[model samples]
Target: MIFTRFTLKWGKRHWALVTCLLLVCCLVMPQWASAHAYIVKASPGENEILVAAPERLTLEFNESLQTAFYDIKITGPDGNQADDGNVHVDADRPHILETGLQAGLGNGTYAVNWKAVSADGHPIQGAYVFHIGEPSGSPAGLSDLTSGSGSTGGPLKWIVSLTDWIQYLGLSVILGTLAFLLLRIAPTSMTREPMDVPGSYRLLWISYAAASFAALVSLPLNTLYESGVALNELSWRLIGSALKLTSFGQIWMLQILIVMLLAVTILSGYDRDRSIRARIWSSYGSLVLVLGWLFTHAMTGHPAAADQRALAIAMDFIHLIGAAFWIGALTAMAICLPPLADKLPSKVRGEVYWVAIRRFTAWGIGAVAALVATGIYSSLIILPAPVLTSLFTTAYGLVLIGKIVLLIVMLVFAWRHARLARAATGSRLSGSLKAELATGAVILALAAVLTHLSPGQPAAAGPYQETKTTDDGSAITLQVSPNVTGENQFEVDVKHADGSIVNDLEQITLSLTHLDMDMGIYEITIPKNDTGVYKAEDYISMPGRWNIKVHLLTKTLDALDAEFEIDTTKP
Candidate 1:
């Protein structure tokens, strides 16, 4: 038997320095990430009063949308269907959704409720109202219209997170174990000898099966999530639609194919002759397949939606690989090392254990460095500047903080284990290794929840007011109370050149258009209030710069139009 000899001189001071660097990175890195798809503009805009009923309704999002499981419905004031039952995405513009409405609809408020799956596979839904001529009675409020949609805290969401956690765990183990075997174990073993760690191999097979099952099950769960359907409502048709029509489905299918190929490669190489060249090729093949599998996750995640998409995806992939090496290898060592050492001769046992631990420590340091650097870069790119200051308040930020805390704890355990490895004391190391693995599992759970959360913090609730002078020497002030997305009250006060209130207006119409995207104009009728103020409530839908044109019809039927630009923020 031939054993490889090497010297490793890492100590506590080095570990402390690394720990401080990680802490500094965490403190300085900006926080708060982005979110899934949202409505950027809508025709027959929320709470808008139209002179004539529209032939169709349209919605435009901030990002490209998936047609699979997309739904938009119009309900008339009488609670009957107002839409033509055919809703589809615009061919030329992937971000726009349009549906024909029943023609010649009577004067009343109509509801437009929409649900869609974003390109990144997250499901988002919203509801709004628009009136024809005049609003009769009150339509269902936004909250009431969205009441039936599943909340983010339900059993279904948790179940999906659980599946995600399991899949992550399984992948980590598979990749980490392979890395451990090829990079750490193989070089030390004789060329003719079979790497005979039955426990580790068994763990790998179990992980493979679990990961494969989780991946398969995730497809249907994703269908349920995207379609906004209950378990009982799930069908083959919906699943098939998701698979064929959605980016997530395509990526998932590719992942399954990779898994199949991975299975073949693993099985084919399992009992092959223990030649160095063959082992090297097999290891490289497995590593490449595993990386491809990991890439699918990055494609379906928040990074795919980022502005610097390619770089974001690459960073996310590197983060995943680093995590697999650190957490996965630790788990493998905890389970495989003790028993293997017990079976070896006393003198050789210490040497083997020392070699494994020393190699792992070296790799672990590199993995940790990669994780910290990529994590910081991803956070910076994913979150907007305004949101970074208030990171602790958002759910995503809190979860990420928890993950970081766990990572720091795991690092301490790793450092202790590395110190023990210097003495070649394999027996004393199992407890710390298990501790690190446990911490990693908790971190994975937090990560599962984090992935499902929107990193954008809700915009501050405050009225946005701006004053503009009309050509007729009148001062028109536009105030949007609670100028965040969703429901907001729009009030316009008109004053004559002498500062007297101008109250005798035939009608006040406000035309709103999103300046960031060409989503068409949204005309809203601002009715006169009891106090002589023209005010109405409507849904802003999204956050960005908006151009609002307020048209005033005097008692003599003369029209005056004034334009005002305002910025709305996320809700």
Candidate 2:
């Protein structure tokens, strides 16, 4: 009950602190957006004969890509790398790579291996083989070979990384400063007078707040740049449109709330005559900040769209809030502990600092537990199949592992810090604890980077999708695309034995049954314009064998029912 009471009272500080922290998180989210699926276009567009050797090999794609992980490999007819070396990104083209090709690649089959990030951050990779007609060992030389050459729009990436770094740093500073202020300024007991923090410490908050605002603004710009939008064309109209869209709605509200809270807090600090109201505004501002944290990442697409969107949203909310609290508490400890220790006699300082550590350690454990439990649940709910192998094979999955590792490291440092705090050593162990906090800073930074990694879905280890077509002198043709989404479109045409077919079937009922149970059904009617032909669109929920029944209305008052067995599983 005392722990709960203390948390409830002190928790208000976590609100603003977490809000600012979440804002920083938004800047890092594009790293995980959309799994980066993209296709890089090859030069010559499939069918161009060049009389003279081209000086360069070029590639284009529908979307801008992550330069950090993009790769391109070219193989000559003999299946050796044309350059026999890895292709590197050229400063010239941000998204493209330029590499030298081997001097002689005699005509044969040439292959291109490429992996690119899709506009949404998904990693898509594939290889394409092309034939070279001429048979000369003379290696075709390339003066330059890089994609995204003319548009090495890499500034956006750096901006994002920098903003993210500063954001976390700002979080540490803001929360740290506030914690110091609380420990110093708040009354020790009901009868005690409030002790104001020195003007110098207050000044530091000014810089921290400014940095926080700059990061907020930089996030939107960085997002646009990452999406390949031209800076010059990034007008208010586009921003307005984004704000109106659901994807950016949460972020927009978060930013607006952050601005309002900061303004109120600043005004409260300056109103000189309203110290009581100022404290109230500061408290409210902090709460708004926590809410802001909840909103900033409200839009990061994950756990899939609408599959279990509500649950995913809830987990994301909790994750951000817990992160904010943990970060804020650390920041508070760093700023307030030393000064408070110096103010009180060494003995009392030891008791107070140790008590604070006890409180924070409990908090950290609870937050970490929530993070893990919800994170795993969210992962399981979104993925087609949840398996450990996905961690190695998928970007998102791999990133999750990396984050877990960092979390463990952070816990170790926290544990060490807790031990020292409890020991209350006469030796100057505060600096060592500060060093531990610094380690926590590194963990948060790595957390920021891992935020961008995609959590790839576990590839279905199920059997291949099998499609069958039995052409028994029937006019019907069925085309099926086997994806897990369960959508299938088919056309059936009936013909007379004389080869003259009725123009259209009045009514056609198509039903799929499995072992006498009706699995799915569709009803379609054909117009007179298309004689004896009927078309139907339907989906089967899962992969299995089923009997397809087709009821056709013939030209007369007669009707015919035909049945076909279909095996839905395919390779």
Candidate 3:
């Protein structure tokens, strides 16, 4: 095979040296990983009732945001545009987004809708409402405004995940197969003529082609994601703007360029009769290009947003290479070993299998060590000690747990194969090798999903409280305990003007409306408790602005209404 012919003539010492260097690279540097951008502060503040209309709307995120493909708008109670329609990031602070509102705004509720791209290229968006003077009901069709606009859900997310899986799989195959041929097969077969495994070479080509195609496809997908435009609305001009303006687009372009160069190098230098020095140079050159390609993946992922960005990126890079070395090499062995074994004499084939298995076992040990070390560091960085308890409860953590489980299964298979190799029975271990490769594929798929999910933290907990005065001068205090996206306790206390509890109401009816999406109204009746506090328990199905309307009826057939807005968040 052309790829096998380009394998480097490195001994055991060289392999050990490279492994130590990677370990040093990981241990010497460390940083805290940061996930997608979220609102840290807002000008009008969520659910704040203002005495006067503000001239501008501003939002600040926890991290610096991308300049390209961001939006900030304000809509009035009449469902018309309230902002000047010119949104911009602050010149001095890239994390802050601001937009000017129209002059002489009327007194009513207003919704601030925003969308932004994080530094690591993930798209994040949300909506919140702040009343200009008093809480009137939300504007008509307000819920339909930004519905399904977030890139976090829908068919686009699944498509992005699929592309990520393909890219990871393809890169693993390319890097792993090369490592296997150079470290395991070439050293032992140097004295013999090179093995003519056409199937093995074909696999490498297919992987390379797939990786290249995925890299190309990701360009348009990323454009769609960042720009927040419909698929049908995507144009070459928008794509060009994204490529020229965003960090993600630049990194992707660099990766594609490297892949093209790597392809050219491989095709132009494929000669079986090349000199030893030329072969060594070609092998080292290809290795550098492949490592560079892997580096781009690290640069555009979560690690790039870490506090200690350089070290974090280095660790991520090493982690990816280790995965490729283990999973990719196993795949190569599954394809190449059987064919090579069939072509040799029975006695010679048994000896070759034993030697190949032993060498691969050594490589596996090093790869596993690197994977474990890097994996632990990444886990700590992504899920800090404070949030470690949420590991099994969160989407990111659950996917990580699945990957760890598969890794354990792969280790068991490796251990069994190692035992056979040590006993000189490695020739019968093809089934175990295939099983390990299949498990690794599942692990990679889980990893793809993990990349798309935001790490979970302890949900923000507290009572959402508000007080309003009815037309009759009665004080109405409403409180929703732990106002998150789940079941919550709603307590309403009605007091006379003199501060004594009023226990004469006929009944208390509570109406809940989701201000972000049109899920319809949810009504609940609150019974007066022994303490004279009207209370009820109900569920808040999703995260967003919620309007709770309280109706109180006196025993004399008199009715009074009070409304409170509660901003419910995700748990």
Task: Judging by lDDT against the true structure, name the best candidate.
Answer: 1
For residues 1-571, could you state the per-residue lDDT of candidate 2 as single tens digits?
1111122132656555545544543333222222333233556322233444334455555334445445567766554676546565545654565555566455554555555444333334544333456433222221122221112234565465466555655654554444434443222332122224334245336645755675567646644643346777776655554455323334556665676666566455444476664664564565456355444543443422324455556766676555655665666655555554565655555555555665666566666656655555555543323245556555456656766676676677777766765564452335556655665666556555544443433323332222222243334433344422244555666665455665655666666554322222333333334645455544443333456676666457566566666544311
Worst 10 residues of 3 by lDDT: 1-10
Model 1 sits at a Cα RMSD from the real structure of: 6.8
lDDT of 1 at 110: 84
What is candidate 2's TM-score against the reference? Answer: 0.50
C-alpha RMSD for every candidate: 6.8, 16.8, 8.2
True-structure lDDT of candidate 1? 0.75
The segments of candidate 1 whose C-alpha lies over 4 angstroms from its true place after superposition are 1-5, 9-33, 140-143, 146-153, 185-194, 272-280, 345-348, 423-426, 457-571
lDDT of 1 by residue, 1-571 (tens): 4456655676797678667757765655543234577666688775677999999999887778777878788888888889998899988998898899987799998878888776667777777788898787555544444411112325667778888889889989988888777776433452233345647668778998998999989998878877778889889998899899988789988988988998877765565565656655765787789888888887876886776677778878888899887888877776776676676677667666666777888777778877887888776765555445535655566677788889899888877777776766543356666778889989888878867776653335468898888887898888998886676899988888899998888899988887755546777787754355888987675556689998988888877778988766555
Best by TM-score: 3
In model 2, what is the error at residue 104, expressed in angstroms? 42
Model 1 error, position 435 (Å): 1.0
Q: Please, what is the whole-model Cα lDDT of each candidate in the order they appear? A: 0.75, 0.49, 0.73
TM-score versus the correct structure, for each prediction: 0.77, 0.50, 0.78
Cα deviation of 500, candidate 3, in Å:
18
**Lowest summed lDDT window (length 10), candidate 1:** 144-153
Ranking, lDDT, top scorer first: 1, 3, 2
